[model samples]
Target: MSVHHSVSTHHHGGSGAGWLALFLVLSLLLLGLVVAIATAIGDYAIGLDTVFLAVTNGLGLTGADISPIEQSVVWDLRLSRALVAALSGAGLAICGAILQALLRNPLAEPFVLGVSAGASTGAVCVIVLGIGGGGLSLSMGAFTGAFSAFALVAILSNGATSGPNHTILAGVAAAQLFNALTSYIVTTSGNAQQARDVMFWLLGSFGGVRWPDFHLLIIVVVLGLGVCLYMARALDAFTFGDEDAAALGVPVARIRLVLFALTAMITATIVSMVGAIGFVGLVVPHAARYVVGPMHLRLLPASAAIGAVFMVLADIASRVIVSQQTVPIGVVTALVGVPFFALILYRSRPQT
Candidate 1:
């Protein structure tokens, strides 16, 4: 009896560790896949060898011979966009996972709380009304707008008592209001060319992302991931509903507010940089949950990794799907997301 008990205890002890190791391995492999694909598939089409040489030389690892043009294309254009996509995807996915858990709603996503709409409105204001200067100024505007929308949602939802349905309704109202404001600014004030530019941004495009943008995105994603991981235990508590969480001494109200603010900040930062890429936060978390289950500790990192892979692949498809022109990243994400959304809905529907 003692030997049997020992064997069973040992097996149980290793199971969690085993699953975690598997997730980490899978995430690394996905990261590798995205890096390879992003480096290799572009207009100029640099070989894998040249791509590595350019990267290593840039990193001061080794002095490898490569042409200036190839170096510029790989280092400046392709690599920057790829890095931004990965970082943005990871940030969005983490936000979604946190939101879904906190709200106790599987459908909760980063933008569902109206952050993206607010960010878009802010960016449009900068572009059309000249509220702020170009570049950094636009980012600031978007950030401000995002938080403002979230503030409204919080008020309407009535803090901890609001529930998921109330929050979603409040979000919808905020989104419509901001979206309309964005349309008015673009149409009434801007010229045709400016309007076109704004439209592209509103729909999401990474065509103009540079090294500077990548730097900011990397900082935000790394910090957001750290914060989420730190709150992983609290997040798991939230999955069990407010009463249960409070019973566990989780301080449900304070923690929910903090997580909401963090998600808003992360979402706004990405939207300011990349023009509101959609469906990533909604779809990636669900897929990650399906693969890794609902525990936030394992779920957060897995979702980030899967989200990064999804965005990188989407960006690649946007570039190649049409020979001369690039499809908006948001459109690609939506096309992919709708199917997943349907499946989730179907699975979640109550049976007779």
Candidate 2:
């Protein structure tokens, strides 16, 4: 009887693994399709066939005959933008999953640590105060500001020893401080044109991303994913709360620190490049968790894949939603996220 029970458990585990693998493969294929669609659409309106050939040609996988203009539009512009959007989405979602696990709060997200607020303040400084004196780019300034915010959070939370609540409170404080600074800089120092640019960027746009941006983002996302996957077991332990995680010999403080820094790094990179896009981190993980059943090993990858697909679709929406003008990617995400956010709140509310 015991042997039979063991066999049944093993069979169940194997079946679950197979399903997870299938989900990942399907999600990735869906992401690829969405990316192709994103590259194909826009004012120029290339077909999927052209989009494929152009991509294959750029990748040196094929020497398909394609016009230079179409090739450039597909390969040089839209493909890079779509890829960056996918990666940014993946990275943000992973960060969200990590933070939500470590902090034990379903509402927790990458930006809850104030990384986005800090990046915005940094970009504003570069844009308005001329802090870099034309040498410092907005991305660099934002990256610096983001790290600074993380550092401040670390100080306030006392390196995760103070617990998740304190860390969250610290993040809130950091966000408020940085947001106030950003507003002050924009209102007091920046010109009308500068303020307009700042506002658009703050809302998020993929229009400016190119190959270089994609290259940087891919590296960050890959590294973040690798590190997070290595610590997946630890994240799973964290879901039971910090004290329980420590009781499980999970090195609670150390894991929390590493995760906090990793999340800040990933979030800062996305925000600096893409201009503080919101809600992917907040929404994607919850959806992924619902599907994958909250095991970090499964949940993390699921979140990343879902996030990539979601962001590319959001980017497509942003382009077509307004006819001619490109809507801010952040705005598109918020429009989708707000309803989901309300749903989560409604569901998670205390029992009557």
Candidate 3:
């Protein structure tokens, strides 16, 4: 009976692994399709074939048949934006999944930890005061701000002593303080144009993303995913509670501190590149959980894939939603996220 039970458990695990592999492949294909479509359907529409050719030529896999202008539009502009969108989305979603698992809270996300607000404050300082020096300065400032906020939260949370509640409270305090700082900077020091730019950034826009941003984002997202996956077992143990995790030989306090800091870094990197694009981290994990169940190993990859697809589609929508005017990516995410948030709330209520 013992042998039979072991065999059955192994068989079940194999089947689950197979299903997850299939789901991941399908999600990746969907993401590719979205990227292709996004590249082909902008204002100056490049055909799908042309986009492919441009990509191949850029890779030196084929000779260029497309015009220089079309090549530039496809390879230089749209592809960079799509890649950034996908990377940022994947990073944010993974952060959300980790935070939720770490905190054991369904509502936990990257922003709940005050990283975005801190980033915004840092960016505001750069833009309003001209501290950093150039375009890259804003990103540098935001990164600094994000880390600073996380540091404050860690200190106030007392290194996971009381519980996630303490961490959440610390995050809330940090967010409010940073947000006020951002507002004060914008109101007091920023010129009209700077204010307008800062507002657009606060709302999030992918319009200005370039290859440099894409390169940095891809590196960060890949590293973050690797770190999260390595800690997947710890995250799974956390689902049972801190006591259970400690019993399982996981250093509950240390692990929590590490995961929170890692997530904060990933969130800050993405926020610095694209501004504080909300809701991807908050909503994508829940959607992925519904599709893939609650195992962190499966949940993390599923969330990342879904998030990448969602953000690319959102970017396309932001571009085409209005004639000749781009909507902020944050606004697009909010419009989609609010309905999901409502649904989550509705479902969470006790059914009589």
Candidate 4:
């Protein structure tokens, strides 16, 4: 009887894994379809043939040069912005996954734990302080703020020494403190115009991205994602708690430092460029978990992919929501994310 039950359980697990792989492959195919459709829907619509021509030419395939308007639209404007959205989405989602594992909190999201607040602070510091950040000033400000917040939290929590408790508490405190700092800066600013711009950033947007940012976006997203993928198995060990993981000889403390630092850098990199788009990190990971179970190896990549799709779709919505007027992508995500979050919280409630 025991042997029969064990065999049955193995079959169940194997079947579940197979389903997850199928779901992931289907999701990837869907994303490709969305991208193909998206390139056709923006303002000044281009036909699929023209889009293909532009794409082939822009990619430097053996093709005739595109007309100037198509070339400018496809290569100079749309593709770069789309790429930026996708990369930022993927980065934020990856950061959320690691933070969730480290803290062991399903509610652990990048913005909620004060990462966005920190990055917002850094960005405002540069823009408001007249720091002469040159072309890359925005991202630099965001990265600096994000790293500072992580450092402060690390010092307070002692990084897994007090385990999850101190880390979460510190995150809460740092987030509030930094948000207050941002508000104070805006209120105290003598420059009214600068104050308004900073206020807009607090809300987040993809409108700021342009052709010039693509290189930086690609570099950070690729490097940060590669490193995170390398560390996924270790992050999985963390899900079982530091003690059990340590018993398994997983170098718990060392892994904590490496992951925390790497996640922060990735979050900062995205925040610096994309201006703190929310919900991708927080909501998308849970959505992926629902589809793929809680295994970090599968969860991290799936979250990144879902996140990319979510942001791309959100950006499209932002563009079309107001025909003559444009809404920010951040607003669209928040509108959708807050309610979904409430549902999660309500369902997660323990019944007496």
Query: What is each predicted model's overall lDDT from 0 to 1?
Result: 0.85, 0.90, 0.89, 0.77
lDDT of 4 by residue, 1-352 (tens): 4322432333336676687688778878877666655676677887767776777888888477668898778667777777787777888888888888888898787765567789999898888875654665778778889988988888888765777867888988999999899888878863889987876677666766786777877787778778777877667767768876776568888878887787778777777777777777888888888878776667877888888888888877888899965676789989989998898898889998
The total of clashing pairs for model 2 equals 0
- As a whole number from 0 to 100, the lDDT of residue 200 in candidate 2 is 92
Candidate 2 on 58-177: residue-level lDDT in tens?
Answer: 999999998999999999899999999999999999999999988888888978999899999999999899997999998999999999999998998887788778889999999999
Error of 1 at 268 (Å): 0.6
- Measured against the true structure, the TM-scores of the candidates, in listed sequence, are 0.93, 0.95, 0.95, 0.89
Output the better candidate (2/4) by lDDT: 2
Q: Which ten contiguous residues of candidate 4 have the minimum total lDDT?
A: 2-11
Q: Model 3: per-residue lDDT, tens digit, 1-352?
A: 4322432343347777898899999999999899999999877988899999999998899997789999999889999999899998999999999988888888889999899999999998988888756765888999999999999898888867768777888999999999999999999998999999999999898888899998888888898899888998888888778887787788988888788888988999999988999889989999998987787888999999999999999999999999889999999999999999999889888989
Per-model C-alpha RMSD: 4.2, 3.3, 2.9, 3.5
lDDT of 1: 0.85
Cα-lDDT of candidate 3: 0.89
After superposing candidate 3 on the true structure, give the runs of residues whose Cα lies further than 4 Å from its correct spot. 1-12, 134-136
Model 2, which residues run further than 4 Å from truth? Answer: 1-12
On lDDT, the leading prediction is 2
lDDT of 1 at 52: 86
Summarize candidate 1's per-residue lDDT along 82-136 as a digit string, tens digits. 8888888899999999989887888889888998999999988988888855654
When summed lDDT is taken over every stretch of 10 residues in candidate 2, the lowest stretch is 3-12
